[model samples]
Target chain A: MHRLILLLALFGYLPAFTQYKPLDASTINRIKEGVAEAARTTNTISSDFTQEKEMTILKDRILTSGKFFFKKEQQLRWEYTHPFSYTIVIRDDEITIRDEGEVRSFNTQANRVFAEVNRIIIGSVRGTLLDDTGFKASYTQSNGNYIVRLTPLLVTLQESLQEIVIYFSKADFTVDKLELFEPAGDFTRITFSTKKLNQPLSNEIFSLY
Target chain B: MRSFLFTSIGLLLLLSGCQSIPPRHLTPVSHHLPSDTFLPTAHCTLPTFFSPPTFQRALFKASMDIREHHLTGLLFIKMIPQLRSSRCDNDTVSLPAYRIVCSNELGMTYFDLEVAPGVFRLNYCFEPLNKNALWRILETDFRLLLSPEAGTTPIKTFVQEESNYLVCKSKQGGISRWDLYSPMGDTLLEVRGKSSLADPSWISYAEYHREFPFRINISNPLIKLKLSLSLLSLN
Candidate 1:
């Protein structure tokens, strides 16, 4: 009787141990496959975006509305229409800013601060951030949506960026929102609307003034 | 040619007479001094209030044309003494990314560039003014230089050397010469300078035309920027 009771206790504890086990190898492989699929599906993206910057130090926030275009292989353009007319274009690691006939060009590799910002922006549009080797990502399912939380592994990147949370629709895997939190108590939240994916975006669109 | 020579000789003698007056000794009088009565004594005592006396809380609209850049825009300026006291409330439709502030006291303005993340300050001179070491020359006999009422004794009188020149001498040992001609001489708007004696001296002179608004120019040799101002409206 004593031996039977010990056997029953051991058998009951096995299920709990299996329940607490870490995500299996197959589960890890599935996340990688999903990320790769998302990247392949997005070739070109064009959208009308509204950028709102809220400075933690000031009471008033600045709002800017513009049209953004991105093509695979690193071509991007942002044109602001209201409150001012300004254009910024990125082509082959060069950023061009044209404001009221004053044009300035800066090479990405020359400015380290700007280069980091550009990398994040380009990676987001290309869906390459999902596979960013500098960060570790985990997906959580909540409210019928998939939330990907990315934590930087490198010290410098971690100093500037605490984490980046991306929300996507689970059914179609379409990105809807992104939140980037800086270590210095500042954060930028961007929500996308009127998004057109896999559109026929021309290379000339990025080059036009 | 013979008649012209006679006239020239006679004019030279008259000018010499004007400059030869003997200096007179009179007690320095401050009652009629513009420096004594014009600006409030409290303002001068409290050095921090060193801003323009007029248009402290007024609204102004003007058109700015930058000749170098060939850029023209309509600018609206609102000055409020309370709340946003330090900055000029400006709204420009053309350059939507920035706000501009024009100082009435300092006679300077700055552009707050928001979108591009920068700031640019532009200096304007409305009248010729000096604010550094040069202002000392004006205060040596401030009571006499700026007095609206000329004293009783005309210690010296100026007679025209020619149709275009006059010389005058004061009892306190000051001399002035005036040249009158439309083509040969351009009437300058104002002269400004800083006092040689004061620690931080700024002086301004404004020349007003009978029909049009006045011109003001400011020079600060110590500072690199010079300013010019055109009166858009008197009110």
Candidate 2:
């Protein structure tokens, strides 16, 4: 019955994982090179992403589409623009969240979860997630795209998430999609598109409020 | 002597902490309408509009204030239709919903509960949050919020008080429940409950027409907890 709910939550599409079939030494190095090559010259990334959350209790998917911005040295912004307004910005290890008209800021030093999430997201966009010690990593290929699945090893994180899946485009080695599966069956999928990299993004993009 | 004093103080502190639930003080409401004659009966018939509301599906950003903890999450509610074979059974059957399947941003489920029309099912809850007292208070809050089928009628009605069209009062034992309705009595503006056993709790509706309230605010002054939600989208 839980599996049935999960299938419906995934919109009737049951994603079949063929097998773990971890890539061999040479293949792993090649994929790692692809990721490194993409990040070598990239300083900024700006894209529009559509986020979808699935809940067994909800018949229809909860949809929230937004624009994403990232700059080197750990600067990022996620601005939701549909249905409601919300924004989150990260700069210099500090996270700022804006809900409606209120703005609140917190530093990574105070919030380990925020710091870890920032590291995972930013690291995945770059080529640093391969070195993250908090998760056990595995690789799989489907439809020519490489999927790096990271299972949380930390007990605290494991309680919140079972796995994090990042889909890297085989062509550019850039992360095209990110999916976080919870300890329970619910999951959230975020797809990024129309990416602009190596552009001169302003620091003001990460401003509060 | 020191040990005896320490033990006595500890016992006193523990007793005080156990009384976290405050006693409610309810005063009789005075009629606002001058020259009004009709007094509401003890068990008057309530319009279906003022009854507990049922929804097919609803999503709200929820926050709970309990002591020093401020827990927040997304609350998803799906109303399941009761299966009925014959026309006669349609009105008699009730389904379990408002079992709020709550989750955080990472999608970790916090808790799932059926607050009304069925047994309170604590299907899943995160540890440190599985307190029976807190759950009971939460269940009472949700019940007052979603009980669209609540059949209790007003014992008294207050008309045209502070821009409100009408307000009806009901009581069961020591608990007092009040329902404020729009001028047409088609929309329920607020639902308030108070009892000697617990503190007062109320839910206010705003920015809505028809059956669904676009915004809801549920708060308990005694607990210093308030949950404010706006309808982002409805399908």
Candidate 3:
């Protein structure tokens, strides 16, 4: 959905003018290396996710749950199972979206925001967020999870997105939860569970006519 | 010279005569109440739609089709009351009413407005939708949709037409709304227009909620646009 992707872009943060405190160099290096190692073994991943969109004005959160899939070399599928029927699949630089029996396909280059969101989603899944120099990152640990807080540096991005907070399960270094906070204080939280790693996935699963 | 001046004025008047109100039309209209059942009430009861209950708030899953642009999102509508300088004619001072806010699921605000006796304030609107023409259209639609004064003040007229439909037309401030009701006195349709004009870019309401018809569809044929809304929750 363009809306969902736009929401993702609306939540994106790049390192520019931010108040985020940088972690020590040693701590940052360790996290970058650890995430890289863990992602290398994750050839494919399939997980169930629950997304909660909290709107502060109405003081309510809308809930939607779906299935997510990611494969190496830029392939992803996100499908919602309830409230409404919608599906989005990204293979390489192409994006295919199906809504109410209408299937539309377009290249990621068509929309800058969409492309950025695609990059961030794929990067998050593959633990490659450390590769993006646009965001200032801070690392912290609590309980059994490692947390990373990303803040945008540019004024324009800072106006749109406040922060991107990600939580990693210390056991396997896998992402457990992702939160996108907007400048208006509204936020979206996505929690992943029942993840399967390195399992073979057919290319047909990303097919959409 | 005098003759030439008179001719210019005559031409201007002729050109102005060609201008007229926008067209109004409807379908599935073969059913309506008979004209003989026409009646009048001291004050209109149909205006309660404009004045919602105390702390009125509702959530809706909304889909809007504006030309080629299609948008689907959750809509939140809240009515907050305010104490105000009353606008009253004669000895009866009008009571203040609530302000209405419309926003999407992500808290992106659409517009904030209020309509009460001698009060109409449009506080905010999304920039892209704030164009003079578009905003005029939206303002007219909301005014027609939410103005209680439209159905209260003027000389009220009611007529039942073919198809067992009772039509009530209320006029105030040159604005008029024809509220079509079923035989059971339930509102089925509301069409707004200029009081003196047959068709003034009319907007219509349909597909009311089952119980009180809270969920409804609004369509403007002139713009070829439709907005569908379904109640999700109430607070």
Candidate 4:
């Protein structure tokens, strides 16, 4: 269940509808190379994000807004400011979460679920998840973005999550939106805006203490 | 053979009756009026802790401690006003419907449920919480918390002289419940009842601000389950 929590964390606002077509093998290779190149050049990222969760049973959407930060390799911070305040930061092998002003920390190495979820989060942001063998990847191209649909091949993940769709900007190959769909017809969407790339971030921002 | 069968059935009933809910101790007041004593007494008005109109929606930081597992999440409740069928001459009749959804901090939903008077529908439930036993417990808790005025059963009111608290007792679907109210009759302090699962349970509400309780605690000692909710916001 905890693993399902972070897998569900890769959520954001939905993007405008657009026609998408499958990319050819050659085009897919070029797009992958471009995304890899962008990931290599990007050292840091800070952005404001809005997440909306919608379900068939619910009449209104659950809306939340937050700030996102990431440093190269494995430093990440997700802070929710609206509705309620919650913060999760991952540095190296340590994962820290501050909820209701109470701090809890866990070692990723000690928890395989956390380690896998952390890897997926960072990999999704860096466009490195396209190479993850755990999921079957498919590519689609819209007028404004290249969308990668990852269907989890792992049995445990398949029980809760149907698929994950990430939308990358065609120009810079940066992530613009993310969506996670569950087996119960519920979906979470998140959109990133006002993103600053390669910004200098101090280490203290990742500490919850 | 028929006589033997009847004897066995009588013995089973006697044995099962031994495990029924323990009767609550109430100091009898001579002048108290039970609801059944009044005319046209199909339903009685009981003091409720929550006002439906003012409390259309609420969001809470909820935690559940059951046995060795502790889960934390955000609990969102929305009150949807349901209208009676147009077939009825009075179309103005409205019923309170509650939609409850609980999700982790990361926004993963654990359960989605709709509860109304004499109505319960489970729209969605996380695989881990998709147990019949758990559902029975949750259903009873929500029904008692949200809509105690289903009006299906007659309620009897008593004045407890020792505590100076008005106690209301009702039996519905074979489960007996007792609600204790403050002296003013505007606030509900605690609820003690037997759950549908035959587990004795108790719930208490406290720290009211703006006519809403900021803290709620539920306990089922037989099952070793405890749930606590703190108000996060009024959504």
lDDT, candidates in the order shown = 0.44, 0.69, 0.63, 0.76
Model-by-model DockQ, in order: 0.02, 0.37, 0.11, 0.32
* lDDT of each residue in A1-209, candidate 2, tens digit only: 99989978776453553434567778778888889878777789999999888765544466778899999868889888864577789887887877767787877766555566788889987788977888998888877578899999999778667899999989889889988877656678889999988888888889985
Candidate 3 local lDDT, B81-170, one digit each (tens) = 555454663454435354555544323445556665555666665444566655555555556655646435653434454454445555
Q: Is candidate 3 or candidate 4 better by DockQ?
A: 4
Ranking by TM-score: 4, 2, 3, 1
For candidate 4 chain B, which ten residues in a row score worst on lDDT? B38-47
Provide the TM-score of chain B versus the true chain B for each model in turn: 0.25, 0.65, 0.66, 0.77
What tens digits encode model 4's per-residue C-alpha lDDT throughout A94-157? 9898878889887877644456557767897776898999999899988888899989898866
Candidate ranking under lDDT, highest first, comes to: 4, 2, 3, 1
lDDT, residue A180, model 1: 69
Complex DockQ, candidate 2: 0.37
Candidate 4, residue B105: the lDDT equals 60
Off by over 4 Å in 4: A1-18, A92-94, A107-117, B1-25, B28-55, B80-96, B117-119, B160-162, B196-198, B233-235
- Model 4 residue A17 CA deviation in Å: 9.1
Which 10 successive residues of model 2 chain B have the least lDDT summed?
B20-29
Segments of candidate 3 deviating more than 4 angstroms: A1-22, A105-113, A153-159, B1-44, B47-51, B54-56, B81-133, B143-155, B160-164, B171-176, B193-209, B212-215, B220-225
